[model samples]
Target: MTPSETKEHSPMQQQAQTFGYRLLKQDGAARLGEVVTPRGIVRTPAFMPVGTVATVKALTFDQVKQAGADIVLANTYHLMLRPGAERVARLGGLHNFMRWDGPILTDSGGFQVMSLSKIRKINEEGVRFASHIDGSRHLLTPERAVEIQCLLGSDIQMQLDECISLPAERKETERAMELSLRWAARAQRAFSDLAKPGQALFGIVQGGVDAELRQRSAEALVAMDLPGYAVGGLAVGEGQELMLRTLDGVLPHLPSHKPRYLMGVGTPSDLIKSVARGVDMFDCVMPTRNGRHGLAFTWNGKVNLRNARHADDPAPLDEQSSCPGARDYSRAYLHHLVRSGEYLGAMLLSWVNTTFYQELMAAMRLAIAEGRFNTWAEETLDRIERTN
Candidate 1:
């Protein structure tokens, strides 16, 4: 669904026309819903392709849109480093610059900052880190993070918070969680000051893998009553079981009406299971990253094109698939291209993998609306998790 450009409005007018979330249906904890934004209608159980630097790797916006994605995610850390947030705003914001009319979400860059812990210092104000690009120094405070996203004109903006690695001490986890809560408050205040009409700021829940800390984090963010909440700090070496268990403990505390986003998660199986636990949105680099390496996702299971078995196979990746990238090319050809290090191989596989992800989300939305998500998820997971 194409959305019109943002129109200038008074703060009171913008507040009256803020972002909305509507739950259309539910089966068990799974939901069929819509995130109503000025940019577009993002279908619930949506998989936003990771457009880290305002573009999905190896695919154009047309290809992404054709893959049935209602929204795409961009990174704050990367853009702020390279093109600069102020530069983007001067160039008519991210949507105009990128030419994607659909809704766009900008990460707060906290996770990327966390990954550079060796080169960064974290304190009450925020993290001071050197840019990976050129080692330029910059301080990323909660207020600054919110300001960057507002400058980028993101429809859905994330709060800046500290994210610790898994298997951390309770004291460490508690410290980071409490710090994130304080940051969330500052982020909200900054968002209030800078965010334009139709722009929304989402708070992220961080507590590592501890359920008690997860609940505490969720509850505090819930009290803030942001437009959306994200379960961050998962899929960072935490096993699937622990991640799911963490969701079990924390999701109940989040308001049902607002959208719940699971950050940087996961496989197809992860999406299905998380949907059963009440997550509404997701973003990850798995599909494109795996695709660029000769792995493609499909309805049946994972397909490794670099494998010798596919070198002479006459079959397409999926003859039943609607995506031409998946349905029109033979496995033998893809195997040759991948083995030969052809760029076309990466491009086609990225397209196939992304389309497959969108298809999975669509199927889940339908099943949730039909009141059979649990049954459907179990059977589908058994099929898709198996290697082809």
Candidate 2:
């Protein structure tokens, strides 16, 4: 039988049969589970590195896997703009085009269409906007977003839903939330019609910061019974406390049988907090972006590599780090590279930060399995905050 025909007996089925979260072990809400997909299985409490375009900026696919990423997120907005989804499809989809065989999750471009585009008009039908790259005009509706992800052959595709900014009036938030729900329904219908075996679609719940509205949105999406769910619109501009509270409000309403993803959030603290609140997956660019700026994440908080004190320090970034850049490179050498404006500086730091982020996720999973997540989290944060 072909791969699609055998998908039910494949690892993806094994994971799904055990529930979207195949609980290998659990420590409180923290869990170590496998998220089965047609491409491969991803470990829970996982951190997916952001590959905005086809590539993960400066790093090779092999290097990315070596850094311990089970999956990576690609932007539909960027890819559709440049290489065009059709070109990627002609080159054998994103996996072969990008030369990475692992599973990939593609965002619906809804967020970018609203935030990055120069001109945008949103209606029940879809969104019309000018491309940020060259001011090219394009229309992205729920159906179009689904179609683009299908062309890219993503293992997991997100529904195109409206994402509104926070701290807005009640009426505006409700209007945006209602629009997102309607778009989500259309996206789901489109996804179901086109979904091939081994591919899954995730519904997004959007309500800005309103708890009642968040619950309403979650209830509406859950009723459709998509493969998974994502909590969006929290990390846009809200403070950490509010973000966590919003998650707390919506997570309980999400179906437990499916995976829960928190979109575009945050610092290390945000990750820990959200995981404790029962988030299963996350994707962010902080690690790579911050790394490129000479910042490093260590067990002892974030360190700026450009500091003068590092000029004479002989210690590595972290002696116990499994990553070469973190364990083998000295503070003095890294500082010199940063000061000299060498490209290697950004590359090494990005690698280290990526490694660190993965390591942090692994540690959280372990702590959860050991039933010491709270203790571990507190201690970890204390250590990081002390020296930062």
Candidate 3:
């Protein structure tokens, strides 16, 4: 029987019976929706923080939750390499291992095949690569990828797809896209055989920057009718214009009822633009990564705490902000902490930036629900571009 036909909920999935998406509202091409998992509900247009290795770097799980994240993403390739997927499963799954009860999404590690791995080769079966840490050899097939994600007990799991960098020849792009489609089918079969009732495996659309190839990939994946679809292989050196153009061409082919995720996507403006194109979910490391470098994202635009201009600026990042790191601490203090390379600077700024991203998602949801997303997006983008 398929996962959907399973008679009992898996012990790992608590009260969750199945995965679903509910489209609550829309404005133009913008959408407001909820991704329902057995674990919890994720409101869209949602921004999930990257918790690579089951941690969001400097921030604690409580800080992540308090920052308003409904989900966190983990890296499958890294985990399978290090602590190992079996080790995590033996430790009672990633949620138990990491102590985060909210829904978790695990990337199939296709991106790492392009990055991270110092040396690698691709074939019909999967990728064979050396571990970045210890130079150990490992093979990651689509079937093995699905099994690894299943072991983690993630609420949402991505299909293993080969991600290619931009500025490549049409033939090269087409070859990678077709390979990803074949892998998607393999992933689906494995998921059907191994996944629990409440878990979901999403197919990814990969076509580099070629619009026609993108549509071809989307059409084929949509035919599979997976739980969700993700637009992958972008945001890897292609500028904003081509990325948006590709989305404009390909998104309509995807089913409206299923959630649409744009993988490894971008900045505040990128999210706003992608939302306008009807994407439902996103995950990126920009907020926390930039925060660790003393950059804070606020409504007033980017604030670089390393600047001497803020050395005496007694004002908080945003006194009107809800997060203490943003509202309570002065810029002067944060600047001192950051310039001095204090760890608390990373912690507090990470919290502040994370909270800001969640706040942005909440704002987009409200705007989409109220039928004014276009206007709100225009105004918000303008405000965000002005800088600090």
Candidate 4:
């Protein structure tokens, strides 16, 4: 039977009848937990690779699973625009369409739509924007955002919120945050109206960079008692320091029992530091995107495979990696493949990079469970910075 149709929850699912988090362990502000879903349980400190167009660029869903991702993220805006949400639902939802039965989280598409400001107009109702695919006009209401995610059969759905660029005046930030709060209420009402089983909806905290504004945004969303909470509006040209500071300012206000997600955030170091500050789930396209650009993220640090210095280097990116590209293929060969623009280069590097990220999350999970996350992070960061 389909997950939604299951009359009986599994033993593990019984522990969490609906979608939720069970805190397993904690060290400092870092936490280790399990996100119990109908499809499976996602370990805490999870990093969801962005499969923005229903695919993770070059890699297949099997490769994504092999790389250790318990859950993958999809874009609501993109899917709603192309192929259409109704079309996906008719084909048996995103899980059947993508052939991935595991848990899936979908974004509200607010960020992507906001990026098309030149072609979009914003008001109290929602954003009316032009589609990039064919320049067709569309109105993205908060109610419609929840509707799309529901049609996609997303296990974890993000509520529609306004995301603003950094360096904005306090007045602008307050305006956006207040608007997001309104959207959160409308989105929640719409989500509850459907009341789909075995799924959860999350509210986003957005306020640009102001401390008071962020705190206000967090407090408002917290009042809603969302199933999860996401810290948005960072990684939008805001430096790492400010981002972490914002997390520090905002996270304390969110409930610890629920999962805390940092949206569209960043590199290996960024993950390390954010976890240190109490964030649990994260999603980003850095690894796959950079892999396609001829870059590799290793435990030792990032490797620029396109550089000529590696033309004669016989060493692989990492001899210990399970991924053949990092464990078996030599730097010289990888360099040549990248230089020649071979498809294998992108595939191999994408797999290798994604594997490394999962490895990092696994390592952090272990450390947090063992009460050694602080020391582990310190040593790991030192190693990454010192390595090439």
Candidate 5:
């Protein structure tokens, strides 16, 4: 009958039962947990590096692992267009294709669909668009999205959702939210048709910035009884305070046993705040994107390698960092590489930024388990500010 009803006894959740999460500890609204996937187990409060198109930009799979990421995310849109999902599946699926043996999460190409608004049209069926890459036309339906992710063999797959841009009227937000619910049902049926036991399907909650709408979406998606849930549509220009507030509205309705993912979310500060608000997973492009522009994330804070003040600063970004790129390289040297537009600059900075993010997650996990997250977060934020 309904998506929620079918989800209870679906084949997807029946056999393997491998895709599961365990709550290890909790501190206030914050939680500590572990997600067991077919590939491996992802420790809770984890920050997954965005590996769009089957790779984290400027870094190899080994480097991704070295950066402390137990899992990474790939874009269904890009991979489907360039390499083709069928081709990837034929060549041993995403794990072997990307050469990353750990867990992988794939979106339903929904964000890219929204981003290509100029070239796309949405209907009850799906969205049709002209690819930004080669101007080729394509149609992405909920079933097709599920099929593509299934072909990619993602350990965790997101449902195809209609993500509305912010600053919209209540009616527009409601329309998009309702469409997403319908798509969720279609996605569930498609996912159930192909998903194995070890894999999972995650439904996204979308209602723009409207708190009431967010609650509605959360309740509807939660009714689906999916293995994981993601809070979507908030990071689209909503300020940090609103984002956290929106999370507060949705978190209560979500199943505590399931992992909560916040898509394309934010800066270091955003991650810390989201975790404090009970989010268990996050994926963002900030760390590497900022790194390529010569920004370095460190224990002390952010370092702008472009600043002339670092011309002769021989100090390492962080002497205590285990990453050689972050601990061994001098600031002056890094400044030179970045200033000169050298490829090495982007690579090294990406490595360093990734390392720092992982370190942040590790620190939070420890603090939450030890029951001092609030105190630790306050002191750490102050330290980062002072170091900056």
Candidate 6:
């Protein structure tokens, strides 16, 4: 049935409804479930493609839909910089502005402000920074962050929190964590006051890589009882093992019934490992970004289209694949386009990468549901790690 035909409720009504998340199945710590949002239901173990600038890089909304994404993540930092969040709302919110009626989750812009902007100063009130786009000044507090997301009419909104860079001193991490907790409280208040039907607010747990700090942040955010929770500040520069260890440290503190999102991660191996650690949602730019650079991820391993070996090859990138870019286009053609700097090369490869990523998530969901995720993960990892 069409979305219009489906039952509709005001955002506030949906928020008032007791938020429920049921574990449908599991394989080890990996889980399969559904997140019933006011916009719609999203199958857990879901991978939200990054639509940083209100678009999923090279692909259209329909193409993203075909890639098997149940939700798309937009960057508040980018959107607020250009076009402007207020402008987007005036144009009728992100869904209408982007022409994608499906569910959307918007980051609080804190991460980008910390990592991407220049001269960022953090205080009790909020962060003040020069815009990365035009060097214009802007202030983003917890309340202002919520106000922006509300204006964009996001289905899932994140609270503004400080994300400390790793390799940080213990004292620095503690300071950031404490500040984030205070901001989370302010964000909670803002969200409560602006509560609308169908939309939900999420609080992010931040602590760099310190286990104690992570637990503290999680416990504090949990106290606020947000609809969902996200594990942020992990994938910055820490290696995979460190990130997983951090997840192990933090996951136990988060409520099992609420959806757990791991922000800005990662490689295929990373996704599998995070799922095994009980993470339920993810968003990353690796697939599209790497695809544009001529890298293709496959079950057999990564293939570089710039290699001369594919110059005369007649076989598709992967004949056994379902995506047209992977199963239909000859390697030689892809190589030529990529080497010649043609736009279609990036488009096709990006499409394939997206499809592959979705297929990987689908396989993971099925494996967990069937209680064989461990075996599936091992075999999948072995195949991809194979070289020559």
Q: What TM-score would each prediction reach against the true structure? A: 0.95, 0.94, 0.96, 0.95, 0.95, 0.94
Candidate 1 segments exceeding 4 Å error: 1-16
Clashes (N, CA, C under 3 Å) per candidate: 0, 2, 1, 0, 0, 6
Error of 5 at 7 (Å): 38
What lDDT score goes with residue 114 in model 5? 82
lDDT digits (tens) for residues 158-192 of candidate 1: 99998888889999999999999999999999999
Cα deviation of 130, candidate 1, in Å: 0.7
Q: RMSD of candidate 3 to the true fold?
A: 6.4
- Worst 10 contiguous positions by lDDT, candidate 4: 1-10
Best by lDDT: 3
- Cα lDDT of all candidates, in order? 0.89, 0.84, 0.90, 0.88, 0.87, 0.85
lDDT of 6 by residue, 24-73 (tens): 88777898987876666677788899999899888988988877777899
lDDT of 2 by residue, 1-388 (tens): 1111111111242333222446677666666677887667887888999999988876778778877788899999999999899999998899999988878999999899989999999888899999999999999998999999999988889988888877898889988888888888898889888877778889888888899999999999999888899998878888998999898899889877678999998788999988888898999999889888899998777889999889988999988776789889999999999988899999899998888887887778767776888998887777765543
lDDT of 1 at 93: 94
lDDT per residue as tens, model 5, 256-326:
99999999998888998899999999999988998899999887888999999999999998888857888
Alpha carbon RMSD to native, model 4: 5.4
RMSD of 2: 5.7
How do the residues 219-298 of candidate 3 rate in per-residue lDDT, one tens digit apiece?
99999989999999888888999999999988999999999999988899999999999999999999999999999998
* lDDT of candidate 3 at residue 147, scale 0 to 100: 98
Residue pairs whose backbone atoms clash in candidate 5? none
Candidate 4 regions off by >4 Å?
A: 1-16
**What TM value does model 3 have?**
0.96
